[model samples]
Target: MRYTSEHKQATRQRIIEAAGRRFKQDGIDGSGVATLMKDAGLTNGAFYAHFASKDDLVANVVADQLREQRASFDSTPSGRAGVEEFVRRYLSVEHRDSPESGCPSAALLDEIVRCTQATKEAFTDGALGVIDEISAGLAPGDPQSVRAQVIAAFALMIGTLQLARALADQQLADQILEQGVQNTLALLPAEDRG
Candidate 1:
């Protein structure tokens, strides 16, 4: 029997959500279509009905995950305080320990570097949207003026989290997280440093 359009859309969303979590937990190359389908509680044969290929799913997941991240930042108080809150939370031990629910860029950047052009483009768009959100927080009146600072600071946060996760020592990881928060906040304008 044919599924309703609503059912089809819901199934597609389910697949994307599962793929997002699985991809972050296990690198994209580590996650096969069969495993991803199983994670979504759907049969492997049902994969094609929603996505054309693994590349398509990866691109969709990248966009969805980053969009969610941006929206989350949007919920915080605006201005310098918002940016600081984001940095602290992003580089926190909780975020460090939970790769599956953390930033997609931190979890999948290495794998994303080798993904298809379509996937890369999706990442680019999503990343820019996230940057824009942070930039707005830095400069509510003129985000473009502070765009460079936001990009650099955000990059540091992603890298710091990635490095912290790679290390086996939890104490060192926590130290790195603390330093990351300080350094990232320093990148902001002196006037906004408060």
Candidate 2:
């Protein structure tokens, strides 16, 4: 039985969503195609029907995850308040504890740096879109001027979350998250801190 285009698209989306969660939880290299398929409630053979290769799926997942992250940013009030909210949420205990549902950059940046060219390009494009969204909120007057600052702040946020998640000490981890939020917020200009 042939599936309709919509069915195919929906199935593809399901696979991407499942893969995104698995990849974030269990790095891209750690997640086998069979496991990813199983996560999506499909057989290993069904993988090729949706993706040319695992690399292809990785690229798709990265793009999809980043788009979801971007949407969260879009939902916030557009200005310093939005950036503040973003920093707080990003460095929170909830986000730190939930790698599968949290920011892709925080969960997968290390792996992303080693992915295939296509996957890297997908990450680059998606990351740029996310950066642009945050930059606009940081500097509605001239986002370009604060683009570097935004990028630095975002990197700090990603790194801080990663470190917090890696620590065996719960108290240190919580401290990291608190300090991460403050340090990230400091990157913003005083004028934009409103």
Candidate 3:
């Protein structure tokens, strides 16, 4: 029987959501096509009906993740303490340990570095949008300078979280998160500056 458009769209969304989770949990390259299908509650053969290739799915997932990131960036308050809370939460041990449900930037950093142009473009665009959001939270300054500081904050947050997650020592990992939070908070504009 032919499926309805709504059914197809729902199924497609299921595949994208499942694939996004898997891609974040395991690097995109590490997640097999069959596993993605299974996770989406469909057989491997049905994959082609939705996505042309895993790369296509990756692009879709990256786009979706970017939308989510944008919402998060826009919703978060621009106050100094709000920025502190963001840094603390972002660099927390919970965020560090939960790649599957955590920040896509940190979760997919390695695979993204060598990804296709489509993937890179989508990622870059989303990231720049987020950087703009970050800039909004900073004290009023030259746009270029604010963007530069925002970029540094982002680099430190993702890099520190990645390293913290990679370490075998739990204490050191926790310490990394704490230090990362502190450092990230320091990157933000102070109340006096704000």
Per lDDT, the best of the predicted structures is 1
Q: TM-score of every model?
A: 0.97, 0.96, 0.89
Candidate 1 local Cα displacement, residue 105, angstroms = 0.3
Residue 153, candidate 1: Cα error in Å is 0.5
Q: TM-score: which is higher, 1 or 2?
A: 1
- The runs of at least 3 residues in candidate 1 whose Cα sits more than 4 Å from the true structure, single-residue gaps closed, are 191-194
C-alpha lDDT values of all predictions:
0.93, 0.90, 0.82
Write the candidate numbers in order of decreasing lDDT: 1, 2, 3
Which pairs clash inside model 2?
A: none
Pick the winner on lDDT between candidates 1 and 2.
1
Provide C-alpha RMSD values for all models, in order: 1.6, 1.4, 2.2
Clashes of 3: 0
Q: Count the backbone clashes (under 3 Å) in each candidate.
A: 0, 0, 0
Runs off by more than 4 Å, candidate 2: none
Writing each residue's lDDT as its tens digit, candidate 3 over 1-194 gives 99999999999999989998999998898999999999999999899999889888998888788778767765666656656767787888788878888788999978887888898988998888877766666654544556676789889999999999899999999998888888877776666234
Clashing pairs in 3: none
Q: Give me the overall lDDT of model 1.
A: 0.93
